[model samples]
Target: MQLADLRRYGASHTIIQSLRDIGIKDIYPPQLEALRLGLLSTKDSFVIASPTASGKTLIAEMAILKTIFEEVGKVIYLVPLRALAGEKYADFSRKYKPLGIKVGVATGDYDSRDPYLAAYNVIISTNEKMDSLLRHSSPWIHDITLVVADEIHLITDAHRGPTLEVVLARLRQTNPNIRVVALSATIRNVHDIARWLNARVLESTWRPVPLKEGIYFDKSILFDDGSHKEVEVATIYDPINIALSVLDEGGQALIFVNTRKSTESVAAQAAKEVGKRISDGERKVLEQASEEVLKALAEPTRICRRLGELVKYGVAFHHAGIHSRQRKIVEDFFRENRIKLLVATTTLAMGLNLPSRRVIIRDWWRYQPGYGMGPIPVMEIKQMGGRAGRPGYDDHGEAVLIAKSRRDQAFLFEKYVGGEPEQVISKLGTESALRSHILACVATFLAKSEGEILDFISYTFFAIHKDPTDILSIVREVLRFLIEEGMIKEEGGNLKATPFGTRVAQLYIDPLSAVIIRDALFKAEERDRDLTPFSFFHAISATPDMMVLRLRKRDYEKLTPHIVARKDEFLLPLPGEEDQEFLAQVKTALVFLEWIEETPEDKIVGGYHIGPGDMRALVELGEWLLYSSYEIGRVFKLRRAVKYLSPVRKRLAYGVKEELLELVALQGIGRVRGRNLFNAGYRTIRDLKKADIEALTKVPTIGKEMAKDIKRQVT
Candidate 1:
């Protein structure tokens, strides 16, 4: 059905009537139907699982519109990414502004606590921001009548899944009657999710456009379900060749690659092949588009110059490293039919709303460290497949998977095309996650007594493990830690958060941060010099941004200079070492970094970057440690003494540390080398006494030549 017909159908519905009153006419059919049923149904919660490019967002918009019309309370539209939150905020503001529905976006890093947040009818935010607001007891959140989770299936993500689960549980507790609309792609455990949320499941395989799936192997098409024909893979390229066959078919094509490097490679190869076919005019436009794409992909003085060269021939790449604005620009060009082809990573699979006539998977397996090369999950491949078949442009869209061997081709055809997506599992009970979140609960007053906390945690799927005894043992250790920390005081058979507990809660730090801070404080007591809180914070927060010990291309070796420099300053040793104790610490740091970096940028719930979360947790732990260390500082009620303990807080907030500032002010020293010297123990001119030319060279990372330079600087 046409969009006009869908709008007309929506006109009769009460929710759509309200939306129309606000001047919204471009309602997609599936969205309109889902919205209408969501409003009319008795279910408090509902799940809308549809393919990518389908109007899943419109379903959310309709619910927000209905909530505004009913005047019950505020509406919370939760998205997976900060970029998505910004995009949705703009869209909602444009549609809802004239109707007097004030829209506000809270992504946490910017203007986190807006005073007018409560006044706004619609609040678009990342899930983490919402969690923070809930933890901080933001007044606006208590009145939320509708909660719309955009990527509900992400609860399976090990790093981020726990936060989403806890947030949902907390929201349910706060407002049992709240209307929840969970949107996802085709997931296997929709029923279980429905049961968990007590929501109705609305699952549909229908796409506004039809998708044709096939496998390409040995230059031949193994199968084409659309026409039930077996043609060569070269013939499958016929349509692409046809698009290039004439200059008039001006629209661009999007090719999905599994890796960032491959995106550039495929685009370059396609451009070379297509360059032989297209006219000068077409080539000019393609080259310009390709240039824009290359500039987006290039970074730090054109480090990937070879990759960028592909774009000169009218090919470009898209991936997370390109930056959000660049990705958006590419999407806009493709939408406007300005660019011809976009080679992108699996990230293109998750609901970016970009459509193309043909989607190709160049590689089915991606190499991961330790795990080696494994097959791409079927769900991700299917999501990319769904992106094929642009509505209105093509009668049928094509999704091609290029396989290497006969067995590989069979696996792709059977597992990706025919198999169901995996079930979304909970990662809540993992020892690390449980310990951290339980501390957060104690700090935030979510769980007061040991029994109360255990009871709440038992509601999680993590509690459903096969060994109940093992679970109880884990819970016991967590309780003991809390008791020893004095975060919880057992009084009259009930556990209450002490002042220390309340402070940690208000800070919204992870429990692990407290442990780290306590350890740092003990070490500091052994040494007479006061450890700069900011130094500690940066040390803890600096995740390895540039190490790829895993097998990568030879060119990746160029990154060694940058990686070694960061590792030296951060005091991070290279991966190969027999010292188990130091290795264990390095492993912990790596795990923390992985958690921080791997957290989906879109999934940061409450204005918290898992990186920043780790940092904030450390700051809170430092504060608690300071209170424990100097009772006089606590008694005098001196802010600066406590503040001085955690200098990293200011450094983190400003992105400039006092030591860095001091180093930058020095003559003949640049920021890069200044940081190097400072990390090497020359913090001030007085510390130069410790620096001898040869002795400085002997320092773990500093070489003899750098030691000579340090001696000259001291002189």
Candidate 2:
């Protein structure tokens, strides 16, 4: 299966040369099988279940390029995460743009139809973003001839699976002839998914780099192949000792921990030993990388400082807590082999190209809210372990699980070493999951009546894996709720979304969240009560879509008084004292209040017991919800609430006080730069407009280039 062989299936000469330029000379077995199954030549769909790095992406690439060369319609590459979307976008753009292929990425603003994406030959998008585009009925969607669903196994994910399921069903429903290339990391139920999609299945356990499974106990490893090895490392810390042994063998280690704190603590602990192995040249590079991490934030938080220091020693920890830019730096450094040891949470296992020679599962058990401590799913453990080998670098990869005792070692060997991954099941059985989707069906004309809605759902993976009767009840309940809440209407055996329902669907919010917002605003108007900023923030925070801050035990006492003082100011009525959700809403709303009040990022993260990235996520979510609330208010004709929400949405996005909003609106300006200009007597855009470049350069943090750019924007 050479790159040249793809030409038999319509791969262009430029595509072959591009593959060779990137050193992709031969296709792996699974990819070869896909191609043989008419992946490129035919219009059939495929469900490819193979291990990570097994060339699943290349198969999709061949099909995508074939479509483009044949003058087929547009292509949509769907990913489960924004980071993966960005990765695919960059890779495709860099490789194919010179060949006259236009690549675009859409992972922002769920409410947008992204009409601009119509101009691209290929559009990479996260599943949720694609679903939003479908709800808005983006005209370009009709032009799509193929959809490459990366990480298609996420259809079993409880939180995000429903969206992917609905998106796939809807795409197929709208485009009856659309080709699908669904990729997954070797799930047990590949056949079930294949049956649902009516696609051919290609399953394989082959890896470009061979993987070895083992269990570690008492400085010794028992390989699943019935072999034993003794380690000479002199450290009681199991992760550190394991990492050191791998470093001695001239390979890097990726240690997976159960918690964010463990990632940092373990990386810091391993940094001491890892530092001794670094050469002076490597040390200089690591130092530069560390500085880049620090500069990712305007005012580095404590976590950022810790990560920066560890990166200097060729060690780094990664999790959702780190800012996106810093995470990119760490990923790039590790991929370049500048970082010797990388510690990360389960997020690293999802779908990223960062691979290492050794994968250490430091924590196999995680805390489940109601279930106490439970073992991680074998599927997820395998996904994490599959990242062990870097193809073309390491000949073999070791996935080691640490055990403290003989019993634990035996358990690990039997459970994970020889275990089969669980079957993929549909997670579209809950009301919260079906509400927005049902509304979207009606709003987008995918379904017009209850029977048609069920018909649309029959295409979902849920219909195949579970009893349709179960989802039938949930769907009916959701429909009733939508109608009673005035989001939809039933007239003469037909179903349709009202203007409010259409707006809610297009806004990409749960219909219940819209109901809550609309009712709160209406109540406030009827009572003729004026509300504060906290009231608006709290209203959005209580919605199901908002990921509210965790309520610590101490926060209950601390937030009670503030809640009491502002109780009357809230648009929604206060919850009872025993409601933890009430406390969370108040606490989360305060974070937003501080954000818009011009508080430093570090201070806000510290006070809220969250990471800087977490704070940023809250702000981003808050901004979207506020904007949605404003749009919903307009649909309901809540004029007063609409006026207050428009300015507040802008303030939340920039994380600045109301007075500094004008300054932050400029291209190069942010919360900090906006404040610098405001405090320097440039209070508004008008003030900056009247100033010259030289005068603007006098302000703190404003360099000559930036000053000139600012002046250019104003002029």
Among these predictions, the greatest lDDT belongs to 2
Q: Write the per-residue lDDT of candidate 1 for residues 1-715, one digit (tens) a residue.
A: 4333444433335565555666655656566567456444343588888887677777777667667775567898888777789988988888778777889998753213456788888888887777777766777777898899888888887766887777777787667788888898899988877777778778878787888787766545554563443432322443344334222344445666667666655565566665554567756775665565445421212312433455444455676555454567567666766555667777555646677776777767776545778877787888877877778787767777877789987888788878899888887766666665676576566776766677677555444443334466777787677778766677787667666555454444454554444444444444444344422433343222112122224323433443344443332224543433333343333333322232322232112212222333433333333333333223335444445544433333322345665544444444345556677777877676566777566555456776676667667
Q: How far is candidate 2 from the true structure (C-alpha RMSD, Å)?
A: 1.7
Across 5-111, the per-residue lDDT of candidate 2 in tens digits comes to 78786567866776676557778898778877877667889999999888889989877877787756799999988888888899998888877889999997988
Clashing pairs in 2: none
List runs of model 2 lying over 4 Å from the truth.
6-23, 369-372, 526-530
Distance from true location, Cα of 492 in model 1, Å: 3.4
lDDT of 1 at 443: 58
For each candidate, the alpha-carbon lDDT, in order, equals 0.60, 0.87
Question: How many Å off is the CA of 519 in candidate 1?
Answer: 2.4
Q: Relative to the unseen true structure, what is the C-alpha lDDT of residue 22 in candidate 1, on a scale of 0 to 100?
A: 60
Scored against the true structure, residue 410 in model 2 reaches a CA lDDT of 88
